[model samples]
Target chain A: MLSKAVQKYCVDTLCIFAVFLFTTNVLAHGGATIENDRCVFRSQGYSIHFTAYQPSFSRTKELCRVVNSLSETIIVLDFVDEALRKLPVDLILKKQKDDQLYADYMLVDERIYPAGTMQLPMKKIEQGSYRLYVNIQELAHQHEVAENVHQIAGFFEFTVTDGAKEKDQSFLARSTWLFYLLALGIFIYLMALKYRS
Target chain B: MLNANVIKKLVLSFVLLTISTVLYAHGERNQEPFLRMKTLHWYDVEWSVKNEGTLKVNEEMTMKGRVHFFSRWPQVISKPDTVFLSVGTPGPVFIRKFSYLNEVPMIQSTGVETGKSYDFEVILKARLPGRHHVHPMFNVESAGGLVGPGIWVNIEGNADDFVYGVETRTGQTIENLGTYATANVYKWHAIWAAIAVLWLLWWIRRPLLIQRYLLVKDGQWSTLITLTDKKLAATMIIGIIGLLIYANGVTKEEYRYTIPLQGGKAEVDAVLNPDEGKVYVKNKKAEYYLPGRSVIIDAEITNNHNLPIQLGEFTSANLRFINHHVPAAVAALDEDYPDELVADSTLVVDDLRPIMPGETRRLHIDATDAAWEVERLSSLLNDPDSSYGALLFFYDSNGKRFISEIYGQILPTFVD
Candidate 1:
């Protein structure tokens, strides 16, 4: 037979676990999606350009056709130095029509540009690492409240190594091994503690 | 021996006293309407005090009450509407070690709707020892708003002298706030903790061991030592309770510095009144080199208030346009207005000129649009639908200041 103290301990443990699980569930989300496919990030001396394409598209014409197939999109650009939060700069570009240029209201960059290839100067970029995130949401062009679907276009990581050496550039660098090692260490430590306790 | 009835009465009285004192303090603070209205109002504030490891410690934080939008009156919103979580530390002191907004790293900025409730959380590391008032700060659609000014936090130690270290796999070490340091706070805490546990174990078990050794041999000895055992248990319970309370207070003082953030909604009303004189903002030209040209605004000020007042300062959001007649320097666009386009509002042409009663004076303002070159991305004309905001500050014969905010399209007429 279970003693009163043992039963009480079990009940209390269950209560605490239930509270934790409920809290975690309340904080979950579907995901973060991009609103526009076109965007830009400008620092002091250079500008970063971003473009999104369907994996199925192999040629520039196919990419252009895919771009035309979409109705609405949102692009968010985030800028950061080595260790600080900074504002994301928006870019505006124009797209070319059939022998005529028209302002595509729905397909413009943050600066409201038309659908077409645009070039930005390096002078607009500040000296740091930057991320340009483009989220493409295509709503059914016919309906007012069409179901919107999206895809995450991968980001490009680059450094503004103007007059500076690559080794000296202290921006976003690929060092996943470090994070992986830390995770592994934590896993082992937790396992050891679990068994010991 | 204390009977169950006596024990029950003592516990009940202690609970009543604690509850009543807490309620009375809250009641006294809620009496003043201005303090109730203007003071920092906090809601859904969560604070967690943790050890060196990311272990769960104490996670209890309360928002004293709900917040109300200050200066929600129409016709004046110098700063665009924004809500932010503010804590009283120099700035991002903990480096945010690890944080979440609705479980995301993003800072919470959902506009406060009146009477709507929201919860906030902050994970604070063991930093400086001091008691500080941290409040949730919000930037409303206009001039100034701070719900609670400060939280009386009693901190006993300095943060600069504090340190925590994390041992990494590659023999590398990471310090709290990502700063590199050799001091390890964890080692010190571990040593102190070992001592505390040992002391508690000795006191609790020492009496039981003696009773087992001597009293087990005779029934008389066991009966004689019953009082001693009861006294030992009581003393241990009291000591543990005292330690728990002391530890909680020290955790708040030494490690946990809460940012008492304020939350609430504001209502805005804008209408044209005949009696209220209209302020015209006109410029000969609108476009200029973001760094080169200046756009001058001329304002005709008329004091409607019976008493004379002086215009103290003109501030919008994070931009202080005019302060005490002296104009602030033109800051970098990204640094000043992170969310919106920055308009040059430094009144360099004329500084701190006063307007008397029943008199209208022309105020000239030269806003230098800094030089910014746009690389046209295959476009013939620039987009005209860009969002631009304008604001004006006026002071009457009295020290009271009135503000007028304008929102319209800024048509940049290009001159080649």
Candidate 2:
């Protein structure tokens, strides 16, 4: 009976976690998605297709995600939204830490680009974990408050390992805290309902 | 102990917050509020074919307006010296044929002065057929594209009849825009691809897997590459090198006039115009956005001039709200006639009472237009700090024009 209850608890927790993931997908594109064999990040109806090629390393191979290769990588952002063509997009790649957006944590070179195909200068990064932030700002209207600048930012996480393995986790493993709360609620409700008789 | 009600409330709050964040992901309107605030202010906005109206495909239309580079230009952003007047519709919804700044053909980069209003006119050929939101965009050499108010344009008809032809100065006609390349790159790329495929096929034709297995098993595995194959590969490599050299020499001769692009920042004056004593906006506030989609602003106006002037129009962003009565006819006889008053009409403004000069008077102004919803002005919605900037145009009895700036707190209107 104890074993069965534990199994039910685990299943319920996982299911709740799945629901949380679906909700928080608004934050990011469930981390990211591969479209047309390329990594495309979609959030808030805006799409930015990401491509990273090690021209100094391999000419034909396209690697979007950082892996075991400690190479000088060339990252390219092919804007899918036409609106992005006019907006100024700034990219910063630095070590993952709190206040990464405001702090001068930029390891790679940074400059605002006119938004067509922005090819960031090739960067030679040592093998480690890092986060890439793409900050996009569009022209605000004349009536809008001039002091407050609203920005749309996209975050991508990557890791450089000795030998990186593939990630194929269940929904429960990759979800927000809301999902666990939902799962726990459902589990409690079910337990109460089952014992009421 | 958390009760079920508390838990339910918590979950509901979480869901609402998540939805709010998703729905209001900040992009254009909210990003760089300072840039939008201090940059050029667009006024006298007019679309040749009225906005939200349908037009036949390939129809030529113009969007004419004025941009005032104020004295309050920020020093943080790139100096706005060399600016190009540009128009964009989501993407390439229309083909821009000609653009004029103050009646000067401004396709190439042009310069504008601070505290000066430049009249912008763009002639667009509707190559695309659909409902498109077109905006007046300005491109700075150092800075990026600064997009203005967008108007919805519906282009009708089939795409087959759209012709994007430009007559060259030398009497040559280039019909297709995309096919203006000089070199026949496609043909050369195809030939190279074919050569590579044939070269790969030459080696794959022989089923050398079984032969290699046999040779390895029999201990005579050193015979994989024959002498003839090596000689042929060497000759082919030498031939490729010779072809590459010949191609480079031939192309260099074919395009001898080609020059590298010279792109650098331009220097222009940020001259601020001395303020001539005119009407000043004092104590301004927007009461509400009525059901008909109009925001009413109660403003106190002080006419500094000697003559009594009437508030003719209030333009915010690209939306126009004109007075109904006093000057029933457009002041086309005014110095800057068609450029300023073409888009102005008496049907927009709510009141037309004249405010006496040197006297401070409170006037309730109603900015009524469908553009409020289309532009998604937050002042009409329920949000804190929805303050906006507006250009108030005052007119004397003699049809003389005097413009003033209104910068004050604007709060979102909530209906009871």
Candidate 3:
């Protein structure tokens, strides 16, 4: 049996450990974060923000993952860096499949887009994951990238849920998950410590 | 003695603090609220602790700021697709020496994310004279300008003694920036003025106006332009013609490689909605202010392309009434002047889900966002007729884009 102080100390340590893990996980992915109620995408260290919506299903819900919806969906990308003005960014989405690693079934594939706010919406979606491929080569480099965008590219993986996983995803929820996890661990540790004592 | 030494130390520290505090550059006050609360939210701002903010005309300084694009994308606003940064004092007060987006010298559009804050460092060379308000401004290509806090800048004097130059590929250093063009304009204006004066003197030497009046008054009056006068006029005309020809020849020879201006409509595939390429936006109807904070629409859409497309955004009058089923933040409208450059969101539907090729669907969509209210679009009081317009954009997984326009009149209702 342990003293109350020891129990509290152990609880605190476990809480701290849980916090560290959760925060590290959240910060693991650079370039994308929800800050102050906004969905921002960071590329080349510059912060680019975007919006995603499905008019038929949601009006206030902004999406980071593709959700299997009963209706059409839309996503908007806003550029904040002038350096991207002349660069031609190519965006393509493929259905993640087992037969092929590079899925050819493109749902949204645009080549050589001018810089600005761009929207990618789909007429329909399935219940699964999606591979969103973004290739950044200056529009001047279009001739070189014409055959393939892999010359200079980075991609983001997004999941398509059945509306359950993304029901209440918000900036606050995503950013504060670590803290919540910490609290949960602390509570569990405290309960265990109390029972042990 | 100890007390005195302590007081002295305190005094010195206070003086140093004052200088450091007031020396940094400041931006406009009104712009701060809008820049922070609206368009682009700034955070984690870091500036040089060294710049106490006084700078010489020829001297350079640097400052940095961060923009945290949040996810509260409102409808009826443009996305910040093309953004610019500059130091201004009512006008461009400092010539940008260098600008780094996220610490890298980014000269073209840079990729960024909403809900993330990116740092920006700007180096400026003070060029203008006098004490002016200095601030940093971010401009969206089609959106309004957003300005930060303005600081008082006292530029002592012009860098009159300073010279600027550029090294040419041919190994020549050209220093004259303005005098070359200015001197030519002055020379042409002086020549034209001199010619006008000479003509005036020649006309005054004879009562030209009176002679013309007399000729009109009396048919028998000798013709004002006699044979000698005609001969003189011909000689002057010939001289002018000869001078013009000589000037044209000299210019043609001097600028032999000049090319005529060529401008016209460019040829490219028109961005059309894949679903609506062959199908028009038919039976379109709208109900705004649903639940007092949203707009709902029902429309018939058909995809003509072999590929499927999804509705991405609906934009009009600089506002993006996007479908927010996914993560989205409408680029804020720059609240500054020059509404044309207000950074309105264009019809780039890069993320509308794919509608199967040759599929026609009747859809009901709800455009919900408090931005609709914050932008005051739903409660516009200026227009009694309450007419408005919007454009619907569609995109496929392949990234092909399409657009359609809509016009409607509103029936204003109070949320109170």
Candidate 4:
């Protein structure tokens, strides 16, 4: 039989551990984060504002990193750095098939765009884990200083799912387990109170 | 005496703390790329300080540029229906004296449309003594700040020497805006803080949380508040009302000449009509040679002007490819212009003969430079559109210039 103090300690520890787990789950991600109320793709010294839309499905709704429908999607890449507008950039979209990546769509815009905006439209993309790669060609003078200078490149991963499945696995679905843990903690705390009285 | 382990740990901690301080610097780079890229495109930006990029405290500098609202505004962010033109600095390192959009004062938020360009000028006075990076920025109503290219500004002199004086409409001279009313602000804050602390202590002097919870659980929570507590709460509220009335009367008597902060938007028309000179260019075919890092453009050029003209420069996406053979073209490049954006190798023309007036001739021009690959323009050959556009400048012997737009499909050639 356990003493009242030990029981109370176990319950307290359980509640703290549950909160820690919930916080970590909310903060964990591969890439892409919310900044100033908008989704941004960030890498070392480079950033591209990423926004997607499915005009055929949801005309006005804007998407960040995830698309519910497998319909036609238009992705806009905004160059955050002025220098990026002077470099040639290539966008390649690939999906995983049997542990190997295959190209789904590609756009090679190898010109300096004074306007600093690029739009990529992909039609009827399949549902899977897709990786979008941004390849920025290094300047010619950069190579003169070093014989071998790697090209600057970065990528972000996004997922495509059916609308129903996305809604089914929404916040309530994920938080069900958390709610159970919270209820258990409260019950234990109440029993401790009853015993003290 | 401290042991070796304690001393070593202390040194290691000091080093770590020094390194951590660097992480808080350069927050401009931390902004997400989308806000910077999709919201506004700044071009033809010129930052000029009064004295070669160095200024004494209270000295002024100018930042002038054109801002283009990107045509394809991101759908995720709200439309830029309202925006304020402002300068981005590390806080009040510099005080903005005046800001104008298309020659109209931009004192408040105004609506802006997409696919339009506006000229802007911001005059700033140095306030602090340090090297700082400043950028022209626009704060959209829903979206955050969209910053432009940053330039380093050197401010020399002691920060204490800076002062901003203003003469009000009442002919009263205020010495410094920074220190004005600061004492009064502190006094009011201190008075409020003392009262708040007293109220907190009065409540916290009794049992809190667990005891209160027990009383609530036992259905005796109503008995927790007594007549004395109600009377004390009423007295505190009455005291706060009295203090507010007294402060208002004292402020009205002390500062009678104060004016409300200015509010209202200025109207400025942003319309431009560029002159397209009497030189016509027909892009016959364009090819990019992978090995040579060159783009060869074969075009039919027709000069409508009376004087014989030569191809002098080709500018695309703000990169100037100058023809060295044309002395006038080389002279046009300003000394302050960025060297990297100017190609080292000039535009190579197959024929040196000038095109006569009313004569149309097909000539091959090679824009060969390592910059083509460096700038990633060579990738356009593989673009889905496979099209390119550029401005061609023609010059006569007298240094007279004519401009024509050239655009056509471009093909890539892997072989030399």
Give the better candidate number (3 or 4) by DockQ: 4
Backbone N/Cα/C clashes per model: 62, 6, 104, 7
Q: What ranges in model 4 sit over 4 Å off?
A: A1-197, B1-44, B50-52, B70-76, B257-264, B274-333, B338-416
lDDT assessment of candidate 1: 0.36
**By TM-score, how accurate is candidate 2?**
0.49
lDDT of 2 by residue, A1-197 (tens): 44564555445445455556666664442222223223666533346665555545554244557644556665656555545545556777766445543333464344433223455544565566666677766566522222443334666666655422223445556466668578777877676556443
Question: Per-residue alpha-carbon lDDT of model 1 for B1-416, expressed as tens digits?
Answer: 99644554565556444433212112212222222222223432222321111211222232222233323222323333455544444444332333333343325444444322234444444354444444444444444444332233333445565555665555555564345522435754775688678667755765666676677677656465467667877786797788768767866875353565645432322222342343333322333211122333444556555654344333222223443252222211123122111323334445455555566666555443111111121111132333223345555543343444433333332121
lDDT of 4 by residue, A57-148 (tens): 76534566788788877775655544665677777777878767666555555665543556667777678778778877757664322234
DockQ of each: 0.02, 0.02, 0.01, 0.03
Best by TM-score: 4
Model 1 docking tier (incorrect/acceptable/medium/high) = incorrect
Chain B TM-score against the true chain B, candidate 2: 0.62
**Residue-level lDDT for B31 in candidate 1:** 25
Interface RMSD of 4: 14.6
Interface root mean square deviation of every model, in Å?
18.5, 17.1, 13.8, 14.6
* Lowest-sum lDDT 10-residue window in model 3 chain A: A28-37
**What is candidate 2's lDDT per residue for B236-308, written digit by digit as tens?**
8998899899888988986665555646433333323354567787646665332234556777888887787
Whole-model lDDT, candidate 3? 0.51
